[model samples]
Target: MADLIPPTGRVHWVGVGRATGSGLGLVCDEAATVLWGRTVARAEARLEELGLAGGAEPRALAPGALARELVPGDVVVAMLPAAGHPALAEVALAGEAHLVCPGYAAPGLSPHARRAAERGSVLLTEVGLAPGVDHLFAHDLVGAARAALGDRPAVAHFASHHGSGKDRPDAFRHHFDRAPHEALTALLTPARVIAEGLPRRVARPWEEVRRLTVGGETFEAHPAGDSLPFVTTYGLPATWRLESFARGTLRPSGWNAAWKPVLAELAEADAAGVAALAERLAAVHPAHDADRDRVVMSVRLGVHTDDGTDWAGEWSLDTVGDARESATARLVSVPLACAVLEVAAGRVPPGLHQATDDPEAVRRWLTFLTARGIVATFRGDGAV
Candidate 1:
């Protein structure tokens, strides 16, 4: 990935659902001047809000509707729920339009990817923040490590730490305060691990807990799928034991010490007990109840030389007003805008493409994000 890919054409959005703080909506709303959204009402409102009109027309997200009129050069952004993305990708592929998403590249999208390549179109996914910028930063780190040390890194760990908004009218509430054990309940869901050439997997979110301190602030971080995918994605050699993941969450401090009980309950499989525990946790990490809340995350990639020497890398971003417009939304959606351009120009050679797999696209796209107001940084113990 060239840092990241740039926009290659006029954008056409596929889903028209309510654009809350969703990445899809942020992309559609922000690129309103250049892109067309499928939902007529939402598109009109978004257009009116952005002070732009009809660069795109509102229509159903149906491919037949799209295929009959939509052809090459159109960009289809799939911001629908996780289950719907695969279908949407297929729709766009059949119509000869490009595809983009902030979501993971699930097994389902594989077929559409194959078809898109056959059709000579781009099928871009995971272009937003965590999955988007996160992968780009990791690839750069991986590439740099190779340049710095003769031996590729063996054991590597990746982690993302951040907090979501408290339950408001619509926002999902993030826990800020809970017993230390309570926090352990998430042992399986968040941190998942994959080692190079290791047939087995290890998941004990609680056991992987490590206290994280940044910016003079301290918090506990339980590994979240930080190291699972990278080893395979990078195809490291047997000597490499790569485990990439993210675990930085937004909280004042002492959050880790408080959530232990929740973890214990999770182990007990107490359904009602879990819900009650969740509510209690929210009470402690209550939303600021104002529109001024924020999300701060730092994704770090730690590396060890094949000789067992050590190094570190990081991309730390603090996004404010997340309740109003979350980092999650922007991270997922903005990449769609770039994918639109790539497909419009026919640069994406289909098949299955990973953002980190293409150095050029990764660099180009990351550069574009800086202009769009995304804060990015490269820090390492040693220079590339």
Candidate 2:
């Protein structure tokens, strides 16, 4: 990717959603202009309301025009649904431009990865908060811990929890900040984790719920999905006594309790029944355009060593946004926009990849985040 980049580039935003809306705004701040594409007029109108539509060239992404709107050396921020990523990857490759998205690349992206390789374009996925910021923080923590431990035999545990909600409390304990469908899917899907030194897949969502308080706000953190893969991604040695590692999502105080009946209904309901439940939830907890919201995330790595020496390293982020902006939007969009600029400037290495945990890149990225109002603190042996 470093070898492929040109001295400058243009940005094209595909899809218009919560994070993508903010992403377009940030991209516009950096670049002179941006191309905004969406399938629906209502979505485009929303962007216009957010003040993102004016400076951007809005276009309708009708059918196959995704590939036709681009040229070489352009950077495409794909905020399309997960199912649409594979085709978008192909479009990016066909246009010979770098691709950046907040989600993981689908299986259909493999062939396009090769094509991107030949064209010197890159596919960057999983570049959002959890998979993005948390990954970087985990890498830094593990690396720092390893350096401090030296030759000591150690045991390690890692965890990351994140969620967002309105500032004013609500019965549901959460709002549809992003696409309601995505939240619905997260609520219904089973989570995977490493438990008792083995991979444990939970058949239900919101299991093993626990309380978490950060920056004076409290939330319910639920077991999300497998985090063992990050053990290697963070460069923890297999020889270390790795006891447990997991990543989970967080919600406001009464989120799990409020959604319990909804989950129960979804499990036993038919297709139509599921849709009805989803509609009810969305109607009741619609995202408020004028409400302030908060985003909190914590990443901790604990190491147990010989001779009873024990300690842990921790990093956390807590922030709130007002009616005109949001913590969720800024955290998700800024990093992605910065990444696209990095790729354009020849900072990212070539080939297909997800969110990178490279220490240098992470430090730079974190610095950028801090500049953009998302401050994170890190502690080694003591509090920051």
Candidate 3:
């Protein structure tokens, strides 16, 4: 490990998108923060909307503008699209600053991570919602299962789902930078899962949709991304025989039926046609102020030994947005905010980190999240 650069407590938060919620307030309360938006005025407006006016400096996001202001040991919280992260990583590296993002670690960031490790700076990713909170839940469950089952043969299943609220206009919810159609198109990519002790690639994930129940509510679930790597990431013992493993998205029941037409159109449409379709869909289903969102995430693991000892456990989070903040924004940003605070305090080591697998850190983060009103419950059956 490289020597860590002592934090200066100055933070540059880029992007004021939907995921930017009260979490910014958490960062501002702890650091000398600057909120960056497409324009200074837009950033200011968001601060005011977040009731954070005068809480932090506001700036326009001009090319190279943020890099010019960074100093060694400062933190850069990237709330932008995944494509924009590598460039920001470069900026952070050039300034010898630490970087944090709530999205998955892009392959482009690996080189930056190596560089950051050498420079004594940190590059943290996947600390939000599905990738973030879900990871914590998975790690906790795995730790428990390992303690209880040892090297016993076991079967495991994991799923995290975000469903629509009662007031949502349509099945599709636009939470990230991508347009609805574009986001849907990206889902066409194949998903990899370990099933029946064999790795398999799913070319059409939506077609593999299965019904799942979390907290007594049924949802339509399907694989989201490649899950093979997480077997090691989650610290599952290789000696244990595996039955099934997957990481996927969850939607309201009947979601497949509701999205059939749109999926058909997306399957056939070219780029321009997809853009047009997105526009039509947006116009028809414009998100309203009254619109509320809900998120439901569940991670479960089950193990059995030849002696007939059975152990099973599950961790779940189900939250609905209020008039003040959307559930998506709260769940995503709050955990990210906690991560930022952790980095600022020099708790996270330099190099690439994907939400800590350390048991103590996981416990602290869950406590912080629960204190802030985002809570995940756990249930266990049989064994230690």
Estimated TM-score for each candidate: 0.74, 0.88, 0.93
Report the CA-based lDDT of candidate 3 relative to the real structure: 0.84
Checking candidate 3 for backbone clashes, the offending pairs are: none
For model 1, how does the per-residue alpha-carbon lDDT over 138-237 read when each residue is reduced to its tens digit?
A: 6766666666654654776655565543323222224342242344344545544543434334455665556676554555565555455556675445
Give me the displacement of residue 16 in model 2, in angstroms: 2.7
- Candidate number with greatest TM-score: 3
lDDT accuracy of residue 46 in candidate 1: 59
Q: What TM-score quantifies how close candidate 3 is to the native fold?
A: 0.93
- Model 3, which residues run further than 4 Å from truth? 163-178, 382-384
- lDDT (Cα atoms) of all candidates against the true structure: 0.56, 0.74, 0.84
Given candidate 3, what's the lDDT at residue 148?
Answer: 79
Error of model 1, residue 366, in angstroms: 1.7
| lDDT of candidate 2 over 1-384, digit per residue (tens) | 235845256777777776764656777776654555555475568577678666676777887776776778788877877788877777777777788878765465656766677668888877788668887788788878777776477776777888778877688677775556666666667787777777887877566788877666677888875565666677787667777788888788887788788777777876677677778877877876688888888888888787676768888988788666677777887778777777766777657876776878877887877887778988767342
Model 1, C-alpha of 344: deviation from truth (Å):
2.8
Tens-place lDDT per residue, model 3, 133-187, is 9899888888887887787665555444454444343555333323566566657
- Measured on C-alpha atoms, candidate 1 has an lDDT of 0.56
